[model samples]
Target chain A: MEELSKKELVLKQAKLAINFGVGVIAFASIWVFQFTIFPDFFKPEPTIVEFIPDSTEPESVSYFELDSADIENGIHVPTGLIVDDGCQDVMVTCGACHSLDLVTQNRATRDGWKEIIVWMQETQKLWDLGEKEVVILDYLAKNYAPENTGRRKNIENIEWYNL
Target chain B: MSKKDSRRTFLSKSAIATLAAIVGSKVVFAENFPKELEPVGLQPDEVKVKIPGKSDQLKILNSKPLSAETPPHLLDDEVTPAHLMFVRNNGIPPEEVDVQKWTLTIDGESVVKPMTFGIKELMDNFDHYSYNLTIECGGNGRAEFNPPAKGNQWGLGGVACTKWTGVRLKDVLNKVGIKDDAVYIGYYGADTHLSGDPDKVVISRGVPIKKALEDETLIAWAMNDQAIPVMNGYPLRLVCGGWPASTSGKWLTRISVRDKEHDGPKMEGQSYRVPKFPVPPGTKVPDDQMKIIESMPVKSIITYPKTGAIIPKGGSFEVRGHAWAGDLKVKKMEISIDFGVTWKTCELKDPINRLAWQRWKINVKLPEFGYYEIWARATDEKGVAQPMVLPGWNPKGYLNNASHRIGVRQG
Candidate 1:
């Protein structure tokens, strides 16, 4: 008719430009396979941070910059308890339940650190350190005493079998 | 409305209402808080979840003085599954406990008539008896102590094998009589003392009144048939079967008896003693040259393709493990993959209880892989066996047993 309706409108504009170029290369290969293989489905989800009391924001005492070679080898003294002078009353009272590396790995004697702070104030519920129990038993009998570092080495000269 | 597009749409709607009020207040503070009000030396990081009948590959190490361990390939079963057992606490594990007002006294001077009972008159007047013992923890492999060991750096999951039950602590010391000049028995326990010190006695420990009148010493209150898990040692506890489970104490109530060696509070100096001879790893002996550490020796672990484990290069695998020994029995085991210059044996099994543990197996056959290891060892039926290293370090590194290994890999 008019050159076949202008060649069927140029073959319907070349099949809508090859189905919009294969739907833009299948939507750019599914966004490059979701940003290169599932990228944890586009990350960014962890947020939860509630606990906002203290009269709604008046508690800021964060601090942490201590690593001057871990406070000069007593290792990051936040409570490895060796900032000296009664390390803040043994870090607000015996690091509040276990680990100042269990009082810097045992060694005692100010009457054995006042008999282990009176056996942890008469059986481990440790309250009453009234009068700061002689400044935490004079900083745990002057920096954790007890040294006679001996007894341990024994496996010598192999060859024994019998089983 | 172009005032910079309404100020960039009110700054992205106040930054999405401050990120939905900070993630809706952290999901209502983790669904109404209470993990003991948080702030307590915050040491997190050791995860491995799954605790339904345990074996989520343990290794907890200290959840407030309560330690944990299991991964010698989830301790290949044969009992030991009160949630993969292994908790070891020295204090702080008693919160409620009223088990019919618990009791258990038994008095000192080796009794004569002292008694006390309760807990339903000590389980309706005695005679129960269960078995399958194997307690361990005489510093079970104190982290292969080379220059290590001071305490609890255990490995090979300290040790387990359960089925306890209860009754015969020599039929409650022959119905409260004993007294012939006792010669140790002690035992105590209620727990507390992580510094809440009810007069400090976190580890009483005793035994040796002829191994506390052994008839396979018990007194436990069940442990595989349940009831015994208030962090292990609920109402009563003592088992003492193949010794060294700190002479099986745990929350018991009392039981003195003494005459000589029952020093109590982890009995005197060098707690649980050791080094009656080979002293060199650090050397300081002289508490009558130390000794105390009761049983536990010819060990063996491997579990099953665990150390590094990769496999599939030439094939044929198998391996497995378990072993034990302390009141004798294990007999042989062996294995070694190329390290001890070649060895094999294995296939043991037997032991379902006569003081537990056994297991073994073997197969192997890689022949072209790369890394290897494997090891194992064991022995005992009194021919001892085990030590390839780590045999003597003591200052509380107690009995190690060595051998074990594992490694694997392949390509």
Candidate 2:
């Protein structure tokens, strides 16, 4: 290497100093972003609130009593199901997988209810009901038996164009 | 400058470069790795349950009942893969099936001699056949009902066409020697009811003797050249082509030939029956007036350029889909881009198997950037076309053959 003049040596040193300063600043900025800014920016958002209505009123009685008026007048109960003696058990057990509307909408006899329960337990992996099975069956059969509201009259006397 | 100074500078530069490289690698790694995906709409227990080889894109309708539907867009292939086929289970699928021990029993009034055969013996004795069959749930497209049906809400993905390998039902019935008085053929499966009641049948339904004897009907053991998936019925299942899948029982174990109409479970009342005449949606017809649901109507579905897709404003797009008619062959498929105002006939491809869905494709030209509804309608050999709206629905919401509409935005 050739010996540098004093002025040229000063200019070279100045350029080296400027480059080193830039490198340091860049590295420091990245460190600041990683440690100070990133955590706040990437914080998790709050979870969405589910829409299930809570109407369970604290009661001192051994079990929640059904209001006969609500059942007779066809009034919608707080759970969106007909209130009855075994409603609490049904809600806890059946509501785990499906909405209560699936239970209330269809009318079935005691045997039919038993058939459905058997089907559910065998195939759907519903836990054994133990003593609650009897109470649930009786409740469903008593309140939700099939009614004789006859079906609409069949279309009659139309000559078929094709079978 | 001295050689020593130059060497020292070089050493410092290399050290800095190595440090920078390590920092760069860490930053890149953080940005590129994918985050864990959580299952949507699943309970805690359901999150752990996994269907082996199943696509993650399938929408789970119910985890306990194991009801799922394939997204219509994902069904692009002519023959649906076993893993992608929609799963609709009435009961829990048996955890492990012993194929060796499984036996199929054929008995009832029609048989010359009641017979029982192990799966191996059955496969060995019967002549094997394979066909591409489309099995659609009767409740398919039930979600589209206005009032919403009581059962699982399924989109168009409730149906799938798969290559089913099995023995023909007619051949088996012939081997067993059906009597002249037999009027119906009832089916039973090994899957138990929910209550585990030994006496109760989860869902036992059958077909008229004439329909059961159809050449296309089969007792399938394999789907898509593989052992049938557990959810689809392993060991054996009845492949009742062109009818409600319920008639084709899964995990089939017994076939009962009857002298009169079989009154099996799910056969009575309005379980799978619909009104004889067109009735307004939500109307309940008397049991005597109801007729058992049979052959599905002609229908078409657009599989490509899924609904709500956005395409380039001036690009040419190809519209592709599949069409099928129950029993009858598909004669023509028409596509409409302007909400059924004007229609263009699509080129229909030859079906791989009889009664299988026919694929259709057409080149579409987008004049300008706007929203468009692509409608596909199929007409059967009998000249029956799909209705513009859902044909009159009964309480059960069956046989919805409205023209499939896929909305797309051109931008």
Candidate 3:
């Protein structure tokens, strides 16, 4: 036990000596850096020489991409319009000239919509709809007919939250 | 501790950590906890439809001929930022507009002295002036029409205020001498029709001779000290303050002075016209009776706290907003929390200049924690106050200057 204690004292002294040696070395290194490397901070040249590293790696860069789902869904992209059950031809023809919202948002009777078509042809320079006019009008009037798309429901009609 | 003891403790802790990581990976991924750590900043959210040169927050009402508006909350800035200004286009903007080659022609039947001036000539010859003017779409409240108006169905967001810097349109008109019989002035723009027809003009609207001569009316080249955004007309546009924004033609290339009222394409057939008399909802009025809309009505919008703002139970709400009347001044403004039954007058400030919207604010300490709506109304210099409910319905659903009601909650 006495021999073990003596060995422990030797180990403790060694640890102390090692710590003192490390402190001295650290001080010397800092002093050397101040005179050698640190002088560059006061140089006439810009200290931040090419601070931005060359971007050769793809991992560092990012880009925004239009998701194919966004285009098919017709929400993010402006041309993404409400797709009715069977209006593929309508989508192609109408979307080619102008937005489909002009057709969907306008709540008109068959005649009202027809008048619009005539106006578009007369002044707005829309080409003749041919036989497809009737079919497209049928789809529009059926789906987006004049319903109650006015202002928000009155405060009385909305769901109430208790105080 | 002894060295061996410390090493054993470290090894055991390291083993426990590795075991925990193995289990945690499975649990976190399965339970959606890993989604929290997954980077979201790199990808764009699908909800917002980003428009070029516009805030992504803007609601796009139509894509073709691109019509969009800023929600009242988003339009809370005193002088609306040029980028944030709403877009109301009748045709696609001209592409690759070379500012150096841009020129404006002044001619028509009533112009005795027809003149053409390059943009540089306009800048060098005339004095430049800047004014913060409010420009609200005629169909701003069209969505509120009961029968559902046939046009863009715009909400209250289709309005904004901005500073336009340019020479007075009146000064330009005087330079190009107007005949004694000059009744109105029409403007032509570089924008082509939707059909790609070279012959067709997108929109050629005009104000009366008196309105055209106003000091605020400008042949604007700069908006907020910057070349105007392409959506708001890049090189030049007419700034017809206090009138329907449609009258403020964009992409201006030519001005035609007319002996009679300007009979431009959109000037006729109830495009920007209201009924001669107050009509019932959904009344089919004739084109002759549809009078041209001169000035907009007095209106106020609550810009602060947004509509769905929630305050702490004991907190008092501070309400702020802007008010403007077409061609006149907003004299008094009031806020009603109890549905116009009792109204507390808000401290309304005078406009910075004529045609600029005046800002106002009030602090309300509500009695209870509950759902509440703050209704704001304004009276014009002519003693005209906004109708609390929907105003008289027009065929095209123009000018429904009803009180702006912002619904809020206290909890």
Candidate 4:
């Protein structure tokens, strides 16, 4: 039977510990050197783009309230009347939902508006007009009618831009 | 003990220690970096999950058709092609119809009589006119809101400026004298409501009386120089200048004047409201908890040399942008070359229309060419210019009028 002396055993253990310690030290040294010499290589550079942070807060900009001063200043003067030929009563009743501006701004004939009214009744479930439909149609026909004024000047000059 | 063994052991231990140090240090460094500074690359393939059927059968605004899947950022052009314009239908688009079969009926509580008429009779009966107006989505520029808001994130190009051919609104009002008790006028489009609770009611919206009399407002049948694109209300639509885009209905069908304000899905509950005060971004405002939306704030965007364009340094470069306001004219546009340190007022071209966007062009020497960040800010007639810093945040994204900052290479 081979027997190891205590001193020999101690030496063997010491040698193993030293080898492990040295190997670790060497690996760490390489990492330190890399970080110092090439720090940027580890991290990607951020995009150099500037973006304006949008505010989610809704700002109370302004609304179209009746401005006597604006009208008096001649900025927005009252235009002449718009009456449909056969729908005075209907115009009055429909005006209840919105302003005459809503009605007069449109350039449709009586049939177009009629379809809209039908759609509203059938789809939107608007209250029945009872007898006011005829009067409204007459007024729309009389006042706010379609006019073909050639081509719109502003749109005509919108030159196309290349992408 | 072998000398070689001791040396090797010592080296290994030291290496391990160094590795341990590096790993520990890396964790600390990573935690300190800000999220914004982190490289979050472009998500080219990102998909938006939306509420179902909300976007079905959406029409393109221009002649150029766009796949419904197109991203909003891809629409950065001088004029958003008709197909590229955002489609925001209140209801399903109606199939084309014969004008012969069409009729417009005006009804509801009013002093005048209720009426309905055919297209021929209406056309033969009334006067008509046209005007230029700008229509924008109510949620346009939502992406620009700080703190982030909840809604469709529209880019800057959601708005389109076009000449609307129609008759005067005041003319019709004059025909039907209001009974003074009328409070609101509601409009309905030909579109069908999305799949939801049937009891929820059909889509409708309304505007007030005073605005109806404004001469600039019109009932338009034509957009640009041609018939109104089908996506934009083919038969007839309202054109209210300086109003929120949602107020101008599309696929318009019916108009009813009401004695009192009508309460409905889109009238009192949707579209035309703002946060009473600043809230956190991305918050959904509760219904009956916001202020009514009104005029748009002064805003501008640079169109030329687009952001991130490479330009020759020290050469003469032209910077141009479009500026507009709710009710005022653009008196001045300023350019900052030194990143807000110095500013030079740019030259503005003559305004084509009194109430439309004005083009401003600035020829700058761009002296000492280098990679410079260029920005443009517009000031309105009211002396209100774009704020350098956003005021705050809200649940519903509203006005995002921050000046534009474009990156350009000067060299």
The lDDT values for all models are 0.68, 0.71, 0.76, 0.54
User: How do these models rank on TM-score, best leading?
Assistant: 3, 2, 4, 1
Per-candidate iRMS values, in order, are 15.1, 19.6, 18.8, 25.4
True lDDT of residue B307, candidate 2: 71
List-wise, what DockQ does each model earn?
A: 0.06, 0.01, 0.09, 0.01
Order of candidates by lDDT, top first? Answer: 3, 2, 1, 4
TM-score per candidate, chains pooled = 0.31, 0.68, 0.76, 0.56
> How many pairs collide in each candidate, listed in order?
22, 9, 1, 116
Per-residue lDDT, model 2, residue A44, is 77
Give the winner by lDDT: 3 or 4.
3
Write one digit per residue (lDDT tens) for candidate 4, span A6-69. 7788889999999999999999999899999998887988443322223662221111122344
Better of 2 and 4 by lDDT: 2
Which numbered prediction scores highest in DockQ against the true structure? 3
lDDT of 1 by residue, A1-163 (tens): 9999999999999999999999999999999888897776868875655445456542221112233553656644444546555554564355446545556655645775675676555544565665557766877788876654333233223222211
- lDDT string for model 4 (B299-383, tens) is 7777776566555655677888777786578898998988789999998864556556677888877677565666678888889
Query: What tens-digit string does per-residue lDDT give for candidate 3 at B1-411?
Result: 132343234334332223224323211112211111212111233224456689877777776768888888888889998778999888767765777888899999988878999899999999999999999999998877777677787878889889999999989989989989989999998876665444567899998889999999999999989998889888899989889999998988899998989988989997999899988877889998999999999999988867777677777868999999998999999998887789999999998889999999999876787877889999999999998778898888899898898777777
Q: Report residue B214 deviation for candidate 2 (angstroms).
A: 1.9
lDDT of 2 by residue, B251-322 (tens): 988999989887887787777888888787556578898988888778878888667667675777888988
* Deviation from native of the Cα of residue B393 in model 1, angstroms: 39
For model 2 chain A, where is the 10-residue window of minimal lDDT? A154-163
- TM-score of chain B only, all predictions? 0.33, 0.87, 0.88, 0.75
Say which candidate scores most in TM-score.
3
**Cα-based lDDT at residue B286, candidate 1:** 69
